[model samples]
Target: MKALKIAKSPDDAIKELLSSLFENQKIKGVFSLFYDQDYFYGLVTDKELFNKLTPTAPVMPANGGKMLSRLTMIEPPAVPIAVVLKPCELRAFYELSKLEQANLENLIFISFVCAGVLSLKEIKNNIEEKVANANQKQGLRECCQLCENFVPENADLILPLIDGDNKTTIFIKTERGEELLQGIENNLVEEDFDSAKLSSIKEERSRYREKTWQNLKTENLGIPGLIDIFGRCINCHACGRACPICYCNLCYFDSADNDSGPRVYEAELERRGALRAPSGTIFYHIGRMIHVSLSCVGCGMCSDVCPVSIPVGTIFTRVAEETQRLFNYVPGRNLEEKIPISTFEIKEFEELGEA
Candidate 1:
């Protein structure tokens, strides 16, 4: 739990640190987490050549965590991988670890303080113009704006942009992270941060969250209001795809043989009443609530990816806070703590009375 500052020159510090990671082969591959065009992409690092290349491709948020899960199944084993992820991604990975779908032993998690990311269209219209005008449009991504996970959890290294400089304030949160930084400590200068300043920063973040939640609650006042909050959703599942925690090999929606079958169409034709074509926005959200509410880390990426701009993360966090409080669980705070759902007690639900 040591806090340190990179050298005065931020980019130089980043390059030096990355080069060292490459030199030791501590990083088998580097995954650059950035926003490009209008979506989030993970660019794999070329360790052999020490070059960072966006391989003939890019993966959206849908493929991000799921791809990591599939990597665990590779035979002969793959090299230890380095991934730059948000808090939600880490939380998703944590959840997957619990499900036995993924292993975190050979991975290095690097996380950056995210402000918020913008949509693809919004990026093209807004950020692209700014970056193009500045002649720096080469490797940028569009989803960096609306990203709200400024501080990630369970990361080996945490990078935050502070002051006018991109000087990444690197904090070692784990023993592995401390060991990695130990090798590069000589290259960096240590600086004691002002306790008051850190407190102020936290307070500011809290204020932002307070306002965000207030606005969302005000916008969705009641049941009808809540329905209206997601009324514009076309059930595209874009929100699910964008969510780093919504990891399922095969989703229920992927099924072609729905139980309703012909009755669904018959009922629709019988009355002028319209059946919500892509039903289950409410159900999808509720299911997620029940599934991950105890582990929600408030990354805010879910709301960022919603097409209609529903504040899904806010609602999830608001509910998750209550859920975690009830169970006395805080995801990612300590890896040793057992997940609430994973353990049970005979007397836990005794209040329900004997059957």
Candidate 2:
């Protein structure tokens, strides 16, 4: 597929393109994000809302994948729709589809050459300045800073964000994309591709990720470190709510059994020195790890919505890497690769847990 280069600011281009999509009846709907004066919001198709879309507006405190699931999980749209999302969001949504929590039948995936997320300050004040300035580089969120997968791999359409490369052409990656974008050839250009720029960027990102992993492993990982970071949790379960993959309609942690009565509290105080008021702090955290570590995509929604500001996403991601490595699986890399839980081979692992 031929890739498109985005030379000028993308907001103008998006405005024109999306307006056309709405008018052409090519798509029944559109799903993406928009930024106002102080906040960013996930929005569905609205021709009334132009030049306000910001698909790459950094600082995503929540996962857009969760939003997509709400739109398409139970019932896919009757007609095709275009949805713009980040790479990580796409990955998480893919996992949800595997669990039968979402369907992708009538949706078009649109993504850009991602450079990772930005800080909230950058999103609010520096967005236009940073986009306009060729010399400036936006600082990434912690999850984004350590991320190895920065580009959207299998989207139907992709736009380039690499600096100084904007002859801005959109690459069609699927027959569906071709159908939707058919004959609207006014703004797009296609040509011979060079993989050097993207490769170099990936290499640098990989190196940084390796270094960050080493540092995270050496200094701030393991059980004790996790407790230290998460000790402030008030048992709010905000992290679970924010996570797209933690899709249990009735989570065990928040059930009636977890509510502590006077007798339950007295038993707890008898066993331990002091009972943490809203009990099961460690239980909740451990349960989360065991339940979703293999599927965790580390979108930073957990950290973003945490009331106490724990780095929940990074902590889960670090542990998840270990667990996923043990199983030799990546959460959303391929739809065909069966999850470790479902794929059993009795012939394998003669002494699986032996020391």
Candidate 3:
């Protein structure tokens, strides 16, 4: 991989690079996290606003994939724009693109070896401390703590966080990335990505994932356990709202057809003798599981936004692991990879019929 070593802090180095890109008219705008009183994903068009860009912030209030979908769903940009996304968020964007929920035309993707993100629950407390401990996995979101896909795929440019010399290492992975850095004065250095470090981290997270998922499985075993875990749901749908993969304009649960009249509630109440006030709560969870399990990137946005702290992201991710394995598929792994459900195979599932 081609490398560009910038002798500045990661945030500062990235800011400078993006500023140069914008000033040189290489990219019309940059999509990254911006710092106001809080960090949020936004587009920075004016060079003056470039300093406010916080591309490596440890907190993720929402997945960037949903924002990109909104930006390019109607039509792709006329000019090339650079989008800086975390590994998981970029994966989610790729999944959305495959679903035709996003257009990838005229876009430049810059990703990073993610150190995971702190939960939104911890966003209000000790921002500096959280960022400092981001790589160590303390106080990070559960899905992030166990995430194995921290390495980005299909990224044009990647920022390496493994080096500790206080230099930002930019690895060029594509011809587009090479062209983007062509005009800039760069030091050509032979650099090797620390694959051993990456493997160690992956192994540690794999062990953690097995242990965590085992506990979750034991806790939520049968239908009653599922009901117990999800019983506190107020049907607020905050999880669905925050989920990057749940991109439907109108969710089935929120549709007018789902609204039960008084008589229907009365009939159900009479039949069961009691009913959960917000009915179909379990059904909604199951429905979402069926819909998004294949494409869930385990970004943890769903669980992060859950008001009742239902661990929605964890549950969905666990289910997704099974579904994706069954289909021998990996979501967001490639732009050209077809979604399993969208395709038809005549001989598929023949074993079920034989039985």
Candidate 4:
């Protein structure tokens, strides 16, 4: 692994580095974030256009991985493409790749050591303020605060954002990244990465995350706690719409069969004295959990989109962590790690065998 440095601002240096991918005859397309009306991910061939990218924006309105998954699913690049994604976004995209929802061939992923992301509402749709806030390592959403994977894995390149805004370290992790470095070596200064500083931050974040997990026990959040957490749910399904792991073309909850005839409501009314007008809130949520618990990357999109102000992302992350623990797996950490429910093995986990 080699590190490179530049004497330009984070945005400017990143623009120069990413733009060089286009000039290199090997790369054909670029995928990155841009703020037009709102933040958007686009596939642009023009390297110069990357100058406008805000890849490290503090708040994410939606998961960019879902968009990249759709794009790669529909059509792979005829030539190699360089794509820049946040660590969480890259992790979600990696999860989708395992499910075959996304193809990874001809794609070079660029990721960075993430600080954390905040609530979009807290930033109030202010783009300038959002960019400025990216430097702060605290005041993040619940899910982000608990996230331990600050540095991305399996990325071709990892950009380390330092304490200051102007200077940063670009670490080349893969052969694909080395190729890009060779192209821009003249412009880059060789620098040793500040491992001590990075380690200190990781230790601090991990300690904070451990404390949060302890506080969120079921004894502290039982039946009434669940109701209080999701009581205001309008059953709008907006959370599912925003989730990157929910790659289903049509959700089971959205099926016509789920909206049964009058007799179904009558049966429900008979069973429960009276039902909530928009019933099945808990059912819908659990069903989603059954589907995505093993693959959830904890990107916090569900909580971000919830109109009722529910801590959907935090709840899902807690459940996902437990579910993943049962199988001794971490989603997106390993490309070869099979999703538990998708495969069958006879000898595995016999201790838990009901027989």
Candidate 5:
């Protein structure tokens, strides 16, 4: 539970600290960040080796909080994988684990206190300047700008970039994390905890969330409201794919058995014929609300991945807050609690009528 600081470059700090977890031929695998495929960043884990990081890596896009949900489905689960993730990713992973979509039995969550990250496009535009002006701050991606969950909620090992200090604040939040850190605890320097600063940061984030939801609600007005809100949707389903709780093996839209493509086209034609696209643009949002509202962690990946720049995460978070409040449930807070729909009492609706 003690906060410890270590002086080292970010990359070197990560490599040195994580190297211990792979010691004594005990580690089976690792899931960490690496550059692969067309993506500049991705999650890679070893399915084959135990002693070293795997050379044959399966990398996907570092699309904020989507990787952990997919990690649940990895065949022949990789145990003791050192997953390098952001705070939102950790929160999403915890929520998914609570919903049974993710199994974190042997996963080591190594999270960063993110200031935010730059998109590839932004990186390209200011490549020369970005290289020169290492201190510049405004060139970050839109998703990173809106992100409020900078401090991790469920990370086993937290790496914080405290107050412009390039070194990391290595803190353990779980028994598993403590066990892992025991090996390198001697190298850590004890520091006075900043309770006030931490609280201020959290308060600022909460205010940002409130302001965002208020604006989103004000913007979404009426019947043409839904259309105007999602008018540019090309039906790509990127939001669904980015969602950590949307864990269907073969989704209806993705399945060959469903005539969803044709159905969507026909619905569009009907819209051209003066019929509204009844829940057409918002079907995924509606379907997800019904499916995983209880488990939604509000990581904002849905909005982050939307090509049309819709505020999908803000809408979901607003709805999820109300839904969770109604059910008296907080997702990812505890693993043992039953999901709302899964729990029912015979006397619960006794006042409604004679059953």
Candidate 6:
């Protein structure tokens, strides 16, 4: 309902806002991306480092939700800290909060109207060009191109990534956001949130998602397809490490219980002509899907971290879509929307013969 008029660039406007917050002592720290040799996330406390804050960076090295969980899983900060994240990261945070892996106390979430992001590899080459081409089909991460939930549902603040707009418009979505803007010299201009543009983007992404999903399904539906896709897996478990939703402290797949001894491998090799070394590759993927598909926010971190170029994020997003649809649930749509697994219904899944 309110927009912050930018005197210079959008980044500068955000920096100015952050500077004010720090100088005013409104926040004790900030959790956001900073530019160094590369863009990285840090809990910034020094006022001098505010210039390095690229809260709108087009590269996501890691999911903000996971990083935030590492900071606050055990205990929340004593003072308020501002957290700047992409819409999907914010949604992922909400999911983690529900799973009791993140504490939501004394934190301000700032999200944005994402224009998608470039792949980590492509970003190192011709960064500006890739950012300019973010709205296009090329150079973006697959999940971003097909992401429908770009508009964050319930963030404290929202920065709209509108092209060719000189003034950086910051929308205050909650009282916390309004309070953060106080004592700052900015006019509160009335403007409608651009629902029309958002709807158009959503439609475009949905079309792309369906088209890509169709192609992916054709290649990855049956057992043979699954093997073809997952056969290259080196059993690195990097996907799970990068995933914000895969927050189990001691993953069963990584624990001693899942380990295969030499005798077991020898017996399996004797029964069959050969065995897939470091076996259960496909089982690991399926197990992860069953565990986190309902809460997955499709942030694309898993695919980004995959050394084998497996489209892990895309597969999980596809699975999450179907599972969430069946349960009539949307993760991180709001704080109050109950996760389907945490609740039970007598009539639920009755059509599937559950009674």
Most accurate candidate by TM-score: 3
Candidate 1, residue 79: Cα displacement in angstroms equals: 3.0
TM-score of candidate 3 on Cα atoms, chains taken together: 0.95
TM-score of each: 0.75, 0.86, 0.95, 0.92, 0.76, 0.93
What's the CA RMSD of model 2 in angstroms? 3.2
Number of the top-ranking candidate, with lDDT as the measure: 3
Q: Write the per-residue lDDT of candidate 2 for residues 1-355, one digit (tens) a residue.
A: 6544445566555556667777888876678877666435465566776566777666574688888887778888888777888888888888898888888888889877767776543455656665445231445667776676767776888766654543455677777777777766444455544457788777876776677677667245466776676778898999899898899889988888777788978887899869765667878998898999898887877876777878788778878888899889887788887777768877778686775
Off by over 4 Å in 3: 126-129, 132-135, 218-220
* Candidates ranked, most accurate by lDDT first: 3, 6, 4, 2, 5, 1
Model 5: CA > 4 A from native: 23-28, 36-65, 72-79, 119-148, 187-193, 218-220, 254-273, 276-279, 345-355
The per-prediction tally of clashing pairs is: 16, 4, 0, 0, 0, 0
For candidate 4, what is the TM-score? 0.92
Ranking by TM-score: 3, 6, 4, 2, 5, 1
Residues 1-355, candidate 6: write the lDDT tens digits: 8767666566777788777887788888889988876778999998888889888877898998889988999999999899998999999899999988999999998888887778887787776566656656678899999999899878988877673556687788888888877877467877778888778888999999999998898444787888888889999999999999999879999999999898889899899979986699999999999999999999999898899999999999998999999888999987788888898888665568645
Error of 2 at 12 (Å): 2.6
Which has the better lDDT: candidate 3, or candidate 5? 3
Error of 1 at 119 (Å): 4.2
Residues 1-355, candidate 4, lDDT per residue (tens digit)?
5877766776666676776656767577778777666777888887656666877766676787888899888667778888888888998998898888898889988888777877766666666666675555644777787777777887997788874757867777888778766755755555565667778777877787678678767448766777777778999999999999998888889999688688988998899879776877877888898899999998988987888888898788888988999899888888888988998787887667577
Candidate 4 Cα deviation (angstroms), residue 47: 3.4
In candidate 6, position 19 carries an lDDT of 79
